[model samples]
Target: MKVLEAYDLVKVYRRRKVVDMVDLKVTEGKIVGLLGPNGAGKTT
Candidate 1:
């Protein structure tokens, strides 16, 4: 079954498009991790 879904998710910062038209999905009963560089929008 579907657990989490993010459609057309967009985030802009400092007049710059950080996350543009992002689509993400996560299933149930699972551990998810968001891995990225130090400034790769991880803490944006």
Candidate 2:
């Protein structure tokens, strides 16, 4: 089970967390991609 799940995800700017405590899971015939460049936020 668990087709998709995300927990403890955080994003902050100015205070500068940016993305912290991030967790992600994908199961049951899964394909996932998260590539980063150009400010590195990746559309945060």
Candidate 3:
């Protein structure tokens, strides 16, 4: 089973695509981490 799922996730700012065509899935009992540079839109 999937605890969390995201499909085609996208974020844009000022004509720039921060996140484009991204997919993510977190399965049951699984741990996940997202790491990125300071301005790499990790929080977006």
In model 2, which runs have C-alpha deviations exceeding 4 angstroms?
Answer: 11-15, 20-25, 38-44
Task: For candidate 3, give the lDDT.
Answer: 0.86
Pairs in clash, predicted candidate 3 = none
| Model 1 per-residue lDDT tens digits across residues 1-44 | 67999999998877778788989988888888888666667678
lDDT (C-alpha, whole model) for all candidates: 0.82, 0.82, 0.86
Q: What is the lDDT of candidate 1?
A: 0.82
Per-residue lDDT of candidate 3, residues 1-44 (tens digit):
99899999999966778888989999999988988778877776
After superposition, candidate 3 runs with Cα above 4 Å error:
none
List candidate 1 segments past 4 Å from native: none
When 1 and 3 are scored with lDDT, the better candidate is: 3
- Of candidates 3 and 2, the better by TM-score: 3
Q: Which residue pairs does candidate 1 place in steric collision?
A: none
TM-score per prediction, in order, is: 0.64, 0.38, 0.74
